[model samples]
Target chain A: MLEFTFSVILENLLLATRWTILLSLIAFVLGGVVGLIVLFARVSHSRALRTLTIGYIELFQGTPLLMQLFLFFFGVALLGVEVSPWVAASLALTFWTSAFLAEIWRGCVEAIPKGQWEASESLAMTYTEQMRHVILPQALRIAVAPTVGFSVQVIKGTALASVIGFVELTKAGTMLNNATFRPFLVYTLVALIYFALCFPLSWYSKRLEGRLNVAR
Target chain B: MLYQMNFGDLLPYWQVLARGLLFTVVLTLVSTVAGIFVGTAGAWARTFGPKWAGTCVSIYVELIRNTPFIVQLFFIFFGLPAIGVKMGEAEAAFLAMTINLGAYSTEIIRAGIQAVPYGHLEAGSSLAMSRWEIFRHIVLKQAFMKVYPALSSQIVIVMLGSAVVSQISAEDLTYAANYIQSRNFRAFEVYLVVTGIYLALAIALRALLRGIARAVFPKG
Candidate 1:
């Protein structure tokens, strides 16, 4: 057995941090696109589409993400497809992030007064026209801060991917602890690294929120 | 090969599942009650207590809020033992959940406390209410009334997050699912059923909280 030093463990954790960042990026960007579709469906003029979207959002929001990861990991294997932890974690996280982002953006869009929709409609604008020319642009402004704030959640969420053996920062921390037998030092560093990644985003989001409130 | 869904295989483990569900519920109930108390005190410190206490509370909130709950659990369960602060898995899970929820609810409750109108404090003062009396009777109740929905949602989120506690061998609903899957090789069915239970639990918990809100805050 080779000796495990503090520096060796730290170096390994730093390398694993890359995956955490990449997974967060993949989930956030993809979830944003899918969440936009869900948002549109949620706000669509058709009641059926709106209802279906609500169920979609509710299903994702209500269930635990850890279980979702398990379903994607072990559940997909039942279908004869070999799923890697990376693929399963990404897929599960994308869907989970989409659900939450959709809900958050829905709140933002709904925050627009009803009169804007009516006024745009009276101008002979169609639904798409109103959304493109009127509502979404305004909603996008309010959506920015909370959307950024939610990315902290997405980053924290990738920690669950470790449970599925995704080898992210948390996974690396556990492995190093196993190797080094220094759970206290290893996990503390893991937490501080997560906090370092997350705290700036959280601070920035709060500042943005403050500025938004003042602008109002 | 198409996978056959056999929930019947899980029928034999009904007791295991039920026990797990009961444990999860009990854990949530205990931690939530305790967490809210911590949150209220933390909120009071942040809003009305001394400066050092407020800063300390703010640090605690941010540190917990910024990190993931699982890491916190690992730290308490796996790491704390190194410093001679040992505990069982369930105890560690309970403590971590309470700390996590306390941080979140502190922020939530502080917002509510701050939103309490200055005029209400004046009214309480005019009524000859003591400082503690004003906070207890006027400020705290109104703050809770204002943020009750947000608090309930946070509670539900904490409950859902509690699934991770199973990782520490806490034997939550997720642990039961994992255990059954290991025995019967019914991963898909087990997870699907567990996920459904979680969804049902989330919905029922929300409804229960709503009922409590209605009973507790009759005007709201």
Candidate 2:
């Protein structure tokens, strides 16, 4: 009942890339905001906040994103609230990204020399002021390259949103495979598009990492 | 209005859950064994083997690292069938996990290999150690000692990632959850319970791996 043409398949997949791109952007921007809060909580002197942030990071890092997506997708409906795959996916990925980004940023923060903290403290800067004026600026510099590097991971992660019926690139591949019965052509195109999106970012991440290594 | 939660319904699926956990453990153990071998060899080749070998390893690393694991699994399980390379679900899942872990550990292991101080290698050479002997006793051992923590984390990652293998109906932990939920119409309870199990497994697995690392490198 359906014909599988190369042009037709490519067009459909190209259209699907829009959703993938949008999901990645949504997850990344929102995750960054949440991650910064988490990072601050982690680095602060409050023991309770530190433990809470550690749990947040470990819980997200320990579980598979796929399971998180499943819980979000189904867990909401149990509360008599209806949720689309879009909302659930965004929520799950945002939290997942926060956990990872927070840990990454914390590492960069801790990597700063101890003397910087001492100097800031001696200047009578308040807790927030010390972090804001002194520590964060230097930490932000170290954070940039790794932050960019992790975006590639975020992009690859959007592919999993398809598992919850979000209809991104991987889901599009499955749909096309069903329609065309051409797994090789459809999946190869799918992998190629993913490669095109990811390789440049990975290469850039590596370059930045090299630069960071040289600086250190 | 809040709905009352019921986890009691999941109690009837203990056997299925146990089977799934066993399967996950087996898959991760096998993959870790094979994956580390692939990584060690790839690292060795990149470090000492020919230029073409290094290129092959680099390409392999980037390709696997850049793509999503689910896509890699699908390509192996679904797409490979088109090329007349048919594999059972379990076999395909195993191969995919091994390959995925291999690519990641290659980079991890390579970093370890690089961390071996040059003087140590020279010291081995001074002792009249053969190439294989130097690599086996000095380079590989020290590399493992230096990078075991990172390698253990990666292994746990691969273990958690094995959850995706259930998509191909490999009957791992997630599959057990899927089945239990379907049977009881208690998706939320089933998944939450299964998530707890996974968390426990990850903690325990990390501890176990650390124990092994301690044994392997007593000085460490």
Model 1 Cα lDDT, one tens digit per residue, A1-216: 767888888889999999999999999999999999999899999999999999999999999999999999997788798999999999999999999999999999999999999999999999999999999999999999999999999999999999999999999999998878899999999999999999999999999999999999
Clash pairs, candidate 1, are none
Q: Which residue ranges in model 2 land beyond 4 Å of their true spot?
A: none
Q: What C-alpha RMSD separates each model from the true structure?
A: 1.0, 1.2
- Please give, for residues B1-220, the per-residue lDDT of candidate 1 as tens digits: 6777888999999999999999999999999999999999999999999999999999999999999999999999999999899999999999999999999999999999999999999999999999999999999999999999899999999999999999999999999999999999988899999999999999999999999988888773
TM-score of chain B of 2: 0.98
Summed backbone clashes in each candidate are 0, 0
Clashing pairs in 2: none
Please give the lDDT score at residue A33 for candidate 1: 93
Task: Please report how far candidate 2 places residue B77 from its true position, in Å.
Answer: 0.3
DockQ of each: 0.89, 0.78
lDDT of every model, 2 decimals: 0.95, 0.92
Off by over 4 Å in 1: none
DockQ of 1: 0.89
Compose the digit string of candidate 2's lDDT tens values, residues A1-216: 556689999999999999998999999999999999999999999999999999999999998888999999999887788999999999999999999999999999999999999998998988899889998899998888889889988998999899889999999999999988889888888988888888998898889889988987
Candidate 1 structure, TM-score to reference: 0.98
